[model samples]
Target: MSTAQPDEGTDRATPDALLHTRTGTEVTPEDVVLAAGRDVTPKNLEWAKRKIETEGVAALDKLLP
Candidate 1:
């Protein structure tokens, strides 16, 4: 006879859980702006980078805040 074990690897933390673990100061507008420009889509990345450079970190509000 064999015993079945539950799969722990299948479970992953939700966004809320991830957020809770973050340091409040780490989620600043500057980080948001940089992240926005890092998309894999070439067009979006170019556009985002330009937006960040021209508009500054405030533009990240559309995506982060």
Candidate 2:
């Protein structure tokens, strides 16, 4: 992720633009939080990173809508 900040009205660093910088086919942790109408926190980002490392990216689909 870049050193940029989330746009106004957000509570975390990972904004949708930064979150979607990678392949558009995958849903990032930030996207998950946005889907739930919440802000992405450090803990959430950590959890998502951990899950991806432990279970692989495909495992993330289970947490998506």
Candidate 3:
């Protein structure tokens, strides 16, 4: 007789999980704008830049996590 084990090699991602994977780490201004539900325009990019400058790492954390 042989025992079969569950397969853990392949991973599955839910829609919510996909959002995190797509973003990953290494925050970008475009990411910030999108996370904040804003369009990726030049003005939004500049705003995101200032946000990153002021908040640093916390910016992405606040937006994502």
Tell how far residue 24 is off in model 3, in angstroms: 6.1
Model 1: lowest-lDDT 10 consecutive positions: 20-29
Per-residue alpha-carbon lDDT of model 1 for 1-65, expressed as tens digits? Answer: 99987698867666643443234443343455355656356566667667667766545645552
Give the candidate order by descending lDDT: 3, 2, 1
Best by lDDT: 3
Please say which candidate is ahead in TM-score: 2 or 3: 3
Superposed Cα deviation of residue 19, candidate 3 (Å) = 14
How many residue pairs clash in each candidate at the backbone level? 0, 0, 0
Encode model 2's per-residue lDDT on 1-65: one tens digit a residue.
Answer: 67987788887567544553335577567755554455689887777667666766554555553
Hey, what RMSD does candidate 3 come out at?
Answer: 7.5
lDDT of 3 by residue, 1-65 (tens): 99987689556655653454234467789988998899999999999999999998668768864
TM-scores, each model vs. reference: 0.36, 0.42, 0.58
**Which clashing pairs does model 1 show?**
none
lDDT of 3: 0.80
By TM-score, the better pick of 1 and 2 is 2
Q: In model 1, which runs have C-alpha deviations exceeding 4 angstroms?
A: 1-39, 63-65
